[model samples]
Target: MLIFPAVKASSRLPATSNNLHPEKHKDLYAVTEQVIARAIPLWNLSLTPVRLPLVSNRIKFKCPEYDMYLEDMSDSEGPRREDAKMSTNEKSAEKNGSATCRTSSNRNLGILSLVSVPPHLEDQYPIEGPRELKPDNTVDIWREYEEDGLQIIAKLANIHLTPEKPEYEGGTWHVEGQLHICASAIYNYDSDNLTTSRVAFRQQSNVQRAELKMSYPQGDHDFLEEVFGCEQGGSGVQDLVTVDNPEGRLLTWPNILQHQVQPFNLVDSSKSGHRKIPALFLVV
Candidate 1:
């Protein structure tokens, strides 16, 4: 399996593979890169990086006013301690924002709170807001979906893995909703006490056409299999890239390519772990 390198949040471009030889990959692009896209005009290139001087540094916790409910978000779980006074149920409740380190009943897990301080947005611009509307845009590919209306289907879910059931077997190769799904977005809100996990993508390739174009006379299409490192007999599944999924990360992609969730397990021997995600599918 090919592991992709980590890309920072500022990246807004197609990725070039280090593994691919420039000469060979460019030559294959004529036969393999079948999909070409038209430009869809977008607005607002500036006004980002909201570095407001007055409140940027002042905001410590997202909602400091609600500190009564939260213990403050931390990058990692602190040292696990035993709570002798608490019941077994209370101890296990640690997974749901519950804390064993609390000294008394004054503190409780804030995870269940319906409303709290919004996440601190210093320089980050979350795409969920209504910021990217193009008024003067010409007719584009998505114009059909936007003319009347379109709804985005969302699925809120979490996977819990314990010592008893530690492994999350990889998902099957499929699109988000088979046909109607145009785009999909997955937000990894929380992934605690788990090993590194990844999501993979593969796209259908024009095997017969590519073979005919590249090696019609010789009757030898070995390079199609060897160069791309894929078996040629079956349906052409061109492995694209595997994305490393981490906490607070948002991954979005068009639904034309099939994708799957890679398997993951708990990092610790006894501790329980879970990944909380909300997947959104856009159907036209």
Candidate 2:
């Protein structure tokens, strides 16, 4: 069994005053979309949750320039200090202890600092895994079989990309989409002598809230073989299973505003210039 831990989001670019220009904002959204797209493959393979640590309650966003300041809160002090000492060695020890405390405090605070992004964006970056299975003689029918089974589970996890708010003509935009993903896969092998089964559970936040809804749930022991692009009992099963599957799932946004845009004609002079757009835009 193998275990891959979650990777935290680390890149933080200082917010420039002019970063909110229409073109720049569009670019930011595009980059965000790309990140979501790229992350799908990774999510599918790991069978773990993707947690984007960009959002925090302590940070607030102000337009024009995104200023991030730490919240003002008092720190608690422990019990009173021990007796004072004037010895040379004691003084040196105190100085070293203070320095170490400061260093540790700085490190912990740095980790707590949150990265700020446009309010219209949201993401769930997935954690990766090939989590190790326990050793048991009854279940070790084929070492390669167990390995291959895990590889397929990871691959399925990588293909999904959660939707985000779409870019529009106006400066204001809202992200109101919710993504719910769940994957459960099991591998079982049974014969006259021994029987074994390995199960994996991968679930994501489900944002759908309505009376009627549709969902996709797919799983099979054979899916592992299909992901490896091999047939059952084929060669290289062990090596292929051990390899990580990094591709995530993909999703397509519906064309919800198709009729809103007027058709353009080459010969029509009245349609050449841009028209006044409406204030309220709704996507359902």
Candidate 3:
């Protein structure tokens, strides 16, 4: 009979701390800052700064002209003072151009002049275009795949998105976030050849979340309905031609991915069957 009494569970349990989950507790600012830092160095290497020669700073001057005046004091008796004055006035009028007195500051002096760049300096620094990610550029990932018709190029650019607020209120709710994606493509349109040569700057975004809460206004939801229910058809041709009614277009990630594959596939198929495809290209 030495059995201990069964421990009764307490009605009230001790409250656990409301600490944030590790996965859920993301520092968005820190994440964004890291993304920027990683992105900037890659961009800087791609674009070289254009330099201009400095000009010399100098002062200029201008001068004014005046007529010479002579007084006839000794011969004042014959001609009188009035005649002398008249002569003086006549001489002053005969002067062709007024003399201009100019100081050094009056003349315009260019700040700097272009001088011959020293041979040593020229050798050290040469005129160049933007730093390009050459086919032979030494990037760990890029190099391995470059010859295999795969490439990655990145640049820095600004992006803007619509729907200022996070919530969907009156109008059709559209979620948008903008970011610049610097891209390089390895594909040829003509014979469907594959090689990395094309570079582009794109403004792209993702709609992470969307919801329709309430509707008091009639026209508020119209745009949303239209966006959600739009049909995918082009000039003159439809996927289903005979059908009077066309299916509404649905915006999804798969559709976007499918649209991007054509160009890539064209080049990929044309490449020599023997060449080894890089793992990164396969993942992308």
Each candidate's TM vs. the true structure?
Answer: 0.47, 0.14, 0.16
Model 3 segments more than 4 A misplaced: 1-21, 26-111, 115-119, 124-284
Name the runs in model 2 displaced over 4 angstroms: 1-100, 103-176, 179-284
Specify the poorest-scoring 10-residue window by lDDT in model 3: 273-282
Better model by TM-score: candidate 2 vs candidate 3: 3
Comparison by lDDT, 1 against 2, better one: 1
CA lDDT, every model vs. true structure: 0.50, 0.24, 0.23
**Considering summed lDDT, which 10 consecutive residues are worst modelled in model 2?**
152-161
Report the lDDT tens digits of candidate 2 across residue range 1-284: 11112223211112321224445565643443244333333333322211212322122221111112223322452222233224464357457743211111112221121224432442331122222332331222123232332211111111111123111222222222223222221111111111111111111212222101211113222323322334444442222111111112222111111111112222233222222211111111
Model 3 lDDT tens row, 15-102: 2212323245345223322333333233333221211121111111111121122234245423222322223433454464322121
Clashes of each: 0, 30, 26
Better of 1 and 3 by TM-score: 1
- Give candidate 1's error at residue 154 in angstroms: 0.3
Q: What is the lDDT of candidate 2?
A: 0.24
Clashing pairs in 1: none
